[model samples]
Target chain A: MDFRINDEQRQMRETAQEFFEDREVLERARERIDGEDVVDDLWDDLSEMDYPALTVPLEHGGLGDDVLYLSLLLEEAGRVALPAPLPETLAFGAFVLDELGSDAQKEQFLPAIADGDQRLSFALYESGQESLPRDIQLAATPTDDGYRLDGTKTLVPFGEQVDTIVVAARTGSGTGMDGVSLFLVDAERVDSEPQDTLDRTRPAAKLHFDDFEIGENALLGTEGEAGPTLQKAMDRYTVATCAMTVGAASRAVEMSSDYGSQREQFDKPIGQFQAVKHRIADMWMATQAARSLTYYAAWALENDEPDAARAVSEAKLFCSEQLTQVFADDIHNHGGMGFTSEHDGHIYFKQAKAWETFLGTPTEHLDRIADSHEL
Target chain B: MDFEYTEDQERFRQELREWLRENLPDGWQAGERPGTDDPEENVEFLLDWQRTLNDGGWAGLHWPEEYGGADASLLEQVIYNQETARVDAPARINAVGIDFVGPTLMELGTDEQKERFLPKIISGEELWCQGYSEPDAGSDLASLSLSAERNGDEFLLNGQKVWTSYAHVADWCFLLTRTDDSGPKHHGITVFLVDMDQEGIQTEPIHQITDETDFNEVFFDDAVAREEHIVGEIDEGWEVAMTLSAFEHSMSDVFSIEQRWRSLVEFCQEHERDGTPLAEHTHVRRELARLHTRIQAGKLTHYRNVSKQMETGVPGPEGSMDKVFNNQTEKKLENFARRLLGANNALWTDGPDDGQWVTDLLMPYGKMIAGGTKDVQRNIIAERVLGLPKDD
Candidate 1:
């Protein structure tokens, strides 16, 4: 019944923290937000540390670590608002491939992904759609050699840069979850345009697949059977996002605390004021709770627990809603400085806003949970 | 970071479950109030239930073996709490004695004191109430004016203690009194193991919003407290009081919250709204799911606190965090239950589940105020946990 992370997990987290700090990842994130090309080098540095390979199986030329390891590393990434496709690649890309990809598909892409030579993104949600299987409207018509993809995938993270995109499209006549299938499509085959998102640190794109042709070998798992696989992948992604929120929100609270201690108005540290102090305290409490739920969800997923799906939804719901409040309170605590662009507070604030609605909003996850419990 | 129980712990849980199944009152339903609706009868029933638990060796789980306890591990204690909550078992009648007074005594009591008081506390022979808060010194406990003037081998106690839960039925009290006033308010205080059955002691029950008299105002006029009964050093009982308060706040209430949530979910499932299952309503489902997530997060927070305590051998400020979270979460759940019940929420005996939901809604108000108000807990977290400066 121990809830403490093992020594290895702790060490990995510490190393990642140190690496992120030494690299000045937050400063680079700001530069990226200002339209600088910092992601490539940052991605390379992360690759050098083999972070992208953390979740890839050893048989697939990687560390074979579980989702907990990825969550720990992503938490560090989130602290600095790392502007990379790490979550898309490791959390969604590698996980889905390993879980449902064929031996041939795993042999083809897993090693490239592990080595950081290839980038991957997921195109799950279409226009005005949440991450529900029933919301998918992309079509994959059968062809002589393969399938022709047609539809648009909105909010595809790193869509313009990733080498491959895992597309969830309808392949059969069934509705909702029955007819959905995953296809590993070449990024060049799709028309991708980067969209201006609230979280500029992590760029997203709108992908247009106009009769994009792919061979039979591009199919991931069995056709018309990607419903459960995609759902599981989305849950994993949601948990990973929760881990990131814990990091970003904790950092925001720390910053606000420091600011309150130093920035004074009444001939004393503002932190001494109960109004400010209590707000920060509340933020800290929420952040701690979010972290606990996130870690538990990651553990449940890694261990294949029976309540894994429910746990993931719970974590996502709490992290998304509570962290947004934490960030808002943090900005309020900082007063005018928090409103300035020069301050890093707004960066986390925007990140929280983006995350609050990404993958699934709090309301959406609540519905998912209610459905799972048959309530 | 594992949440799975060990084989031995699982076996312990199974044994406790079996014992409960075989021993609980026949036709007992989970969360059902035991005995009659009469408050005094309810107390008696609870006392008997505690005795039954003690006879089965299920009382005082965290106390040392020599003190008539199992000397259980922290996780086992958590399991004990969780499993008991699962069955909605009757709360121990001697909670104040076991949770606050007994631990404080074990830490600060003299050998004679421990030997004389600890066993009875565990066996429910001597129910205890804490005497820290006065009418004027509720949150500012150090400002209490209950004086204990020295008179030979005993101290003559005077003044009053307010909001002393279980005082009306308590056999003894762990009291704090100002022994000297020549120094600061926090100084010159002393903690005494005072017998409540003596003369010159009067208890007036305070009616609560829930229509229950679970606490009282205890007045002491020339009440006697033996000099040898002092639990700690004279003029330094503030720290002792703080220790007792910490024990009060360190408990995890997530299990009970989860229990209430499970029952509410069942209600939602079985009940109907306009010819449809209440659970099928979008708003009801969303609210239920939201509350369920908070409860799950609260439980994890508690486990994290226990894990931290196990590693450091000392509870941290996270206890206050859990305290605030639990209170707020329960308050929210009870509020939601009331809303769900609608007009039936106002009904007493004629309402759903005999109007238990109304009681549930009204009960958590005192909890939020007791054991340190949620605001006071926020102050603790701000100062101790966040390292924020104290307010001027």
Candidate 2:
């Protein structure tokens, strides 16, 4: 019943935060501010910590932790604004492999992530569309053994660093929420180019899968039932992204509040003014509510609630909407200094702007909510 | 984190739901109180029903059992409201006493106050009306200027309380009076339980746009109040009224909101515009689904608050969040009803077409504007919840 994070979560949060504090999540985040492909070092650290095996069963040499832990890890990655997609690799690697890829896929891919030897990513979201299922434009035609992955997956965050990718490719018709299946492909075969993005922390690439070949083991799950599995992966990713937004926005609000107090105006602390005070107050409430819901969503994910998708939507809705508002209000409350490129406010602001479209926009969530249960 | 009610709680909900289902008294769909529809028949029916509730030991769920109260659990209280609202339950016949005065008395009332007043409220013998907002004071409640000069054991009261809901129907007024002219504004107010039958007390019914004279302007012209009639401490009434207002808004939000959501759904289910039920259309379905999702989210938040109360013994400020969320949802639900029902939503009738669509749509917009406006809630959230600076 309690909304506050438990001691275990606090411990996990500290571990995750401390992990990122030690290194950039992906080398490319810091390197790619000027470079094309990000060289990731934090992945080794994450692999050392076994984050890639985060949700694998205890027998798998990875922590059998649930989405709650993953969400906390996501928050830290978000707080540090890292680029690795620890959640995607860990989640897609574990969930898809376990659910659809058969035992061999699990044995081959999970240990690499669990032992920190290799990483995995999911090529789900298509160009200009947020939905993984409803917006299934990618085609996956089958060959003698496995399927050929085609169509473009734009904005694949940290797609280049991974050893493997689980791509959602259409095997049949029924384009709405059906007609989609996932394929696991070794990235060496694809001729992909990393796309430049405003968010330096998360490097993304436009994956050009010109009829890429994958083995029969590459079909992660049921041949045509990729929609539901990708959805499950998205549940992990959305919650992860939301957790990140919560922590980052929370820090931004904190930084903004402290600045308001010490940085005075009109012969008094600027925060003493009601308008400034009220704006910060709004940010604080928004952050708290958003954080509460994100953790709750995480708990739901861990609990295996059927309503996890809705929780994902709720977390994304609150986090995305509130993060943008908090950053905007934070910047405004700090006044002129908030706009300086050197200031952290602008960094958080740009991050928030970029994230506003990452998983989905607020309207998309509202539309998703419109489709969930109550209706 | 779990939204499921306990087995016992579920059973209790079922039992009450069954009872209310069987006891769906007519004439409530038009939003008219049964007693108002036909005072003799309605009052007799309502009082008898209250007696039955009292006999079942279901009266005053939040009240301690000492004074005819049920001492119910959080889930029990919610279940009672949900079941009661589900069947409409004859408009409670005595909501003023049950929801407002009873909760206020439980919080700040002395033993004597609780003993003397609670049983009557529980038994539905005496109705109560709130006298906090004045002609000049609404959201700026502390600036209320009602005067109460002490004359020996009695206080001579003089002031006008406007927008007093159900003043014409209530037997007593829980009035707020300025006890001290010398002290600061908030510190000098005192809460009094004044009999509406007192000398120099005038009640003038104020007709609303709904053509209802339910609200009244209660005036006190040197109205007398005995020393024992004061509900709480002398010159400390503002705190009591604040507590009461908080309880009022919170209770209204939990039960009334669910009622609004259901009406919207049922309206959508039955509504038609282009020779089809509105629920059949994609946009309409999406709108309904969105509202449903928000309702579930709000329910989760409400359940969290319920859990907090179950452990902590008090509802927190998240009640404000509940109100803010529900207020807009209620409006949106109503708006959706209008869009779906169209011309059918425009007519308010006691017949089959009784303004079920129209009244349900228009009724609650004022709940947000009237109580503590949504702007105040946003401010409360900013300063209290969000740690925002005051706007001054």
Candidate 3:
């Protein structure tokens, strides 16, 4: 069994690397963190590169069902800490639409998403609740002509800027993975309040759906049957986050390695010391493990392997835990400069922490894995 | 990227599995094979098992066909390792011979040496052990003081080698000898293929923490290593030794780790505390799940190593990463098994699972020391992979 990426995937990854590198995305990310509106153009540039369409099906005016390919692009985006909702747009938005969207819904959204004419965001988690089907408290009451959504979706990626928000709300009377439904809502009709997220590069918002009425055509999939579909979508999003964590952790290792080689205290590079050297080595090992698990999870999900859910949870758990440690080690290696907001090291550190808490924390994923295995 | 084996590889795995199923001695069981308690019987049984594997064309599966192997691809070798572990097949007795010495010979041995040694090594006819570490040169192997002075047609070997595994039963040794002191510590050393069944060589078994005698302290006095037995040049043994060590580090142990993890899971599933299975406890489930994820990640890391080796045609520093990861993960897993077993972890022969968890827990310490210490592996990754400045 070959583990190396194929030539096409290699080419796509290389192209993404060149694009992200040439765009000076990291510098722009720092600027955005400093309150400059420098990310919109970069997002548009990514759209021009057709990254949002990378995971859509061929029949939907996009590449095809390739989560692995989309993950590669997300990894590149994560490497530079690109300030955008690329994961939300592609891994969650386009992916869910392709998987469970009706023909009318696909026709209305997929092509525009592929054409980079429309941006999408997902609203899954609610305040003080986990991202589980039964945990969703958002109510989608049946109306005469449609349903009215009347709850808040916290931590919605790109919640304020995206054109459409896919919301997971309770539609039936059942609980615990039953009665959950997906709806496509116009972003303008919802009240969005951007939160002061730790990862400014990928901002989040709290979307308030106060009796937000939508027509029956707005239903993403069959009502009360969206549990598995939403779970799969969340799994895709989790794997995307993992891939990004690999990239960001890798970049952190590189940055720390460079800093260790150049920064000296005892008339030599500090890296010559076993303390620093071994720490970096461990960080490197952790990053490599994260990459391997992320890629395997992505492949498992794409192929619909029997263990896909468990693999996804495993990847999320390992990557989230390891990325945080890698970044902490990195920051420790950089000394004082690593702690400053001005230095690029803190960017990765913050992003690692943010990603660790995103989708699911390490403990949450561990529970998911345990439950999946019926332990 | 693909994780699925091709049909041919699957067939290779199935063939080996079928061979093992039909060939293993009657009443064979994992961890309770022919000789579980007696070292001598265990060695004999392992030798017989290796011969059986050789007869089945599975020994040294990755070796070239010219050398009596199947000429299996790297993936096939991985499959061999995994399937063997899955069935809990007896480990090959001549590991040093097949995994290290033969490969090193293929790379650096003369045609005569290959013709003479390769077949016996693969067949387990002449068991081999590596003689590299010395009393004072464990991590700093290049500083070993094992001297081998050249004479008329042979080298007179006089040195003490420590931590030599299976030396008591080995018929031959691939020795690292310091032939000169004129240059740096890493220079003027030589590798010699020395016969161990001679008066000049003696082995004293070292009882380990596991209460096993798998390790030994070997002393040599005027041991005869002919000039033709030298691998590569006389003073260039460092490169040859590094090659063997790379092979050692690159050997996949993830299958065994996975095996132990499965055993632990079974233990948790069957045993209970206060009317509930251990697996039902949230703490136990979390820990098992965590270890399970780490094991899967370790397996993937090994695949990445295999892929890298396939591309480069040689094991690189990435192998050290696998070694370090597996060593740590395996140690943690075994320790967790003990913790899960509680006081029952102390019982041997009569305890739960016949005290396998206890032995498994004590086993990883040697692994952490063998091939290379985990710290030395980190140093390799730091220096070779990360290009960090070496400590003065």
What global local distance difference test value does model 2 have? 0.72
lDDT on C-alpha atoms for all candidate structures:
0.87, 0.72, 0.86
Candidate 1 lDDT over A1-375, as tens digits, reads 888988999999899999999999999989889878786788799889998888999999999998887888888888999888888898899988998888999998999988988789998878745557777878899999999998888888888878899999999875688999999988987888988889888888899888788999999888988998898888888888888888998899889888888888879999988889889998998998898889999999989898898899899889878888998888898788778998787888888788787777788889988987888
Tell me which residue pairs clash in candidate 3: none
Which DockQ values do the candidates obtain, in the order shown?
0.84, 0.35, 0.84
lDDT of 3 by residue, B256-319 (tens): 9998888878889998998999999889999989998998999998998888788877788888
Off by over 4 Å in 3: B245-250
Model 1 misplaced stretches (Cα beyond 4 Å):
B30-36, B245-250
From the highest DockQ down, the ranking of the candidates is: 1, 3, 2
Q: CA shift at B168, candidate 1, in angstroms? A: 2.1
Evaluated on chain A only, model 2 obtains a TM-score of: 0.92
Q: Candidate 2 — which residues are off by over 4 angstroms?
A: A1-7, A14-39, A44-51, A76-80, A125-131, A134-152, A170-180, A210-213, A248-375, B26-52, B90-96, B103-108, B242-259, B343-353
Which whole-number lDDT from 0 to 100 does residue A152 have in model 3? 82
lDDT per residue as tens, model 2, B48-155:
787767766776766677777767777787777677766666556567788778888887888898888888888878877888889898888888998999899988
Candidate 3 lDDT at A30 equals 83
For each candidate in turn, the TM-score is: 0.97, 0.86, 0.97
Better of 1 and 2 by TM-score: 1
